[model samples]
Target: MKSSKLSIKFRITFWYTLVFSLILALVFFYIYFLSKSYSVHDLQEELKDESADILENLYDKSSRNDILYNADWTKFYDDNVSISLYDKNSSFINGVLPEHFPDKVPFINNKVRQIKSDKNIWLVYDYCYEESPEDSIWVRSIASYGHWSRILYNMLWIFAVLFPITVFISAFVGYHILKKALQPIYTISDMAKEISFSVNLSKRIETSNTHDEFSYLADAFNSMIAKLEKSFEKEKQFTSDAAHELRTPISVIQSHCEYCLDELKLTDSVREEIEIIYKKTTYIGQLISQLLTISRTDKHSFKPQKEEVDLTLLIESVIEELQQKAAYKNISLLFEYIPQNESYIIQGDTMLLMRMIYNLIENAINYGINGGCVWINLIKNQENTDIIIKDNGIGIEKEHLDKIWNRFYRVDKSRSAGEGFGLGLSMVRFIVDIHGGSIAVKSKPGYGTTFTVSL
Candidate 1:
């Protein structure tokens, strides 16, 4: 059987109750037995005093003819207390004797003892009276055991009634106390969760005025968050500054290469070298642009201008623009529109949305086989629109699939530098995120690759 799990509050309460119950049981037993011992001792002493008094009275009345024989013994006896007297000859004397009293009372030890007879228990005390040296009488006193038993029984009833009540009250009170003690922890956890998803890093967990462990924890968390916010801001500033500074140099290099190619007649080898330099400069400019875009997006500075966009026309336009590039590589580009409508409308930035589609289709063309086919399907549904771009080319490995969205992460590192700088997919992902859409890619090496955008 599986063991049931208990929460911290219940587990604490359980241990508390268990320990208290053990202590309570020990105290109850000690009190019961201690009280019984004292009661029995006091009863024995009282009996001894009564025996002495009876002996004194009998001694004073010894000279009378009928003092011992006719004296009223009923005055000294009740239902619970019994007294018996015996003469020196061991003959019966005038005194009260219980119905179940023993025939012979052992007086050699002169000690008190408890004796049971059928249903009744008795505390029997025996005493020897020396009335003159030669004549003596034995006295025995018996008290019922039911008095102390009743006292102990009532005590047990009290404990039986109070034990469960005490446990319940203890558990309830403990639960609330624990909840109050842990409330600050819950508050801190909630604040941390809010900070995780929110861009406002200035927010901190509230701390108490008292100096305690929880206050220390809150202070530590706030300090860590402050440090992280500072580090992130520095990184963003560096990216923005670096991209901006590189833009001018890249443009100067491209212009110099163009001037060299156009203004001077050069050999074929020299012209080829100039064209390569121009191509590299242009690639660097694009990389800088993508970096600036990503930095602006991180700083929440790139706000898309809202406008009605026809997604079908936008996609067709991108395909038309990239048709020559696809033709150069002999790749067939195909478009399949599920709705075939003239306009599939959405509210977004036309330029950014067009960039998003352009990146995906361009990636399909670049990565596909020379004569392979690339399929573009736009499916419209009741709730959303789906754009799928699929290519039968060199599909990505499984390990690199998740990392493709990261900036400057290339799946095939051995590819030529001119092929891709690894910024297109990153920009595509950024645009999808800004538009509150989702993009997913499924690829298997040597099979095919598929990109799905849901908006």
Candidate 2:
């Protein structure tokens, strides 16, 4: 199975949302990093100030050792800050240690270090005081980061909730905007598709009032279609004129040859040559007639005279006319009307319908083997009437089936030596199309060919 493809609007919306979400994620990360950095920096500054004040007070007191021993370490403990002091031996001297504090503090030469535990994060500032050579002491001021962590946690929740919502909203808005932007293109495409050589090419694409790219594109497409319409008109005129001009001369040649053969005394050899000339002239006349019909049909100038046509009777008449030709090859031509009493009635032109049936039967007879059979079945259902022409003849190749309906396209070029100019099927297709009917052919190379025309 083939994979389904995404439409342009969907693709554009997806890319827009993806890029926007990526940019938002980067911005959120930057903000988080900046917030954390600023919080840590502010806490470091406060810890430094507190440490300096404690050190200055210790130096001013005359009995510093007595004051140190008598200091209330619990007073320094608060919701946002914790302080701890240690002596030269790395033993805790005073101040409170928060729960779950590490037994060892890795000193960083007076710089602050961050320590994390299961409960809280701490920023420790290790300061050294040289009161005397033998009495050097270390003061460690630690501050809790629980307040900053809570702020960051709340921000994380906000981002998690808003990211998908933002993406969905952006995708929705982008889809509509892209669809509206491409609306004119869709209109232009639809109009172009409706314009064809057989259709009215005079119709132009509708343009927008705004002078945008879509408007410009519409104008350009209209101009191109106008040129195409003029080209087709010229081509149709040439075909009609050529066919008309050649018809009179071919008829004259055929008539003069017949008159000469009848009225003048001619040798047998000369008479045979004249007969060939007459036959060729007749063929040329038929070819010109077909060309003229096709030209008119292509120009949409051949308007059918609509009437209730008995399709069964039409097929029978065509078969009767072509029966002698089929008999020459010993081919049997049979017709079967499904409902004997009910007329296979349809609204169409009598002449064109007859022509269509004649072409199909003639083709089958010409291509069929000697003593083969051609069957014509007229079937009527609730919706439409079906004319099925099946021939047990030399079947057409699969590759040539599609091109058989094309004008002047022969499935087997060798068939050109016969009475066909390759216009019969093309004409049949055109007649079916103008009548708002459908025709389909099924064939296999060694078996047979079947043409089903539904009207």
Candidate 3:
């Protein structure tokens, strides 16, 4: 997710610039060719007009002499527009041709023409004047195509300079525009991260009043979160209330079992059955108590009473108390401690902290191998204190590692045949959390499991 954070903006900018460049190129080509075509058309019209103007001035409409021979044509020898005279027989009477202008080209009247001559393009126009009904003189105009070509070359150079600049400006502006357009998406993502990290569900994303797609997305997200928060609240409330309601009946059952064993004479089989009932009720009572603890913790009602706890002696006491239980399975409990010149002490809830360690060690013993060993270690330093409990037992599968800290989640083997329900690790995690510490577990299926707590 972090790697692809900028991916959306990159794709938007890339596609936007590509499309903008194509459109700009099309517009550039349109304008360029339009200028070329229009310039040539206008030049042809100008040649026709220039020739007609010159013929009107030079022609002798009243004189009876042959007009081509009688006229003095030196005034017509000028740059930009060339003037030439031709007879009706298509022979050159008198004229001036621009440099490299092909002289062999025959003249035709009443139209402007573009002709290529010796690698040069020239525009030619002919105007006819009648000396009589059957005799006439032609006034021809010639201009080079190079004059307009220079203008087009400069235009090409200008476009060459502006194309990349326009594309760059377009991409830069497009990225910022898309960023603003997608800002609401970023807001939603940040809110999601905040909710996941802090586990806070009441926060809602702010949306604009305008009925846009982003507003709709915000509405959907807020609606889903509201439903989820409501559902979780109902679940937690049910759990809390059920645990409270069942506690009294479980205590009454245990009390009756105790009274039966102490006061009434019972047969061997009846006593064993009663003992099993008492044991099962005791486990259920523990489970209910853990559920209540978690419920109170979730509601922010369970505050730990902090006191200085001896880190070294705590492990020893738990190990001593659980020694008889381990002896039943022939599992040896070992304690490893180092003073390091500093007091092996930490500030936390004594009962909760002791229970935290107690649960971990008991969990190890329950799953431990017969005649195997369990190691409980206490290490202290300036940085922090660590409590490590490890066992060579029937280890957990990789998939069950994450779910062990969740309530009532046990592996299939434990469900079929295990001493306790899967609430011990859940309570252990809660206690560690209440003391502002962290716990981690590592295990392999066939080897063993190890628990590490840091305070």
Please count the clashing residue pairs in each candidate, in the order shown: 0, 0, 0
Per-model TM-score on C-alpha atoms: 0.68, 0.90, 0.79
lDDT of 3 at 202: 82
Taken over the whole model, the C-alpha lDDT of each candidate is 0.81, 0.84, 0.83
lDDT of 3 by residue, 1-455 (tens): 45656578889899889998999999999999999999898888778777766676556455324344665656455557788777788788776778888767877777778888766788888878776878877788888887788889998999999999989998998999999999999999999888765456888999899889999999999999999889888989999999999999999999999999999999999999999999999989998988887787676345789999987777788888999999999999999886576678899988888888888988888888889899988877567898999998888888778888887787986322447668788889878876778888989766888999999
Error of 2 at 47 (Å): 2.0
What does the lDDT come to for candidate 3? 0.83
RMSD for each model, in Å, please?
5.9, 3.0, 4.5
Judge candidate 1 against the unseen true structure and give its global Cα lDDT, from 0 to 1. Answer: 0.81
Model 3 alpha-carbon drift over 4 Å, by segment: 1-10, 54-79, 85-140, 206-220, 262-264, 300-310, 343-351, 377-387, 413-417, 427-440, 452-455
Off by over 4 Å in 1: 1-165, 207-213, 258-268, 300-455
lDDT of 1 by residue, 374-394 (tens): 999988878778899998888
The model with the greatest TM-score is 2
Q: Compose the digit string of candidate 2's lDDT tens values, residues 261-305.
A: 999999999999999999888888889999988887786556988
The TM-score, computed over Cα atoms with residue i paired to residue i, of candidate 2 is 0.90
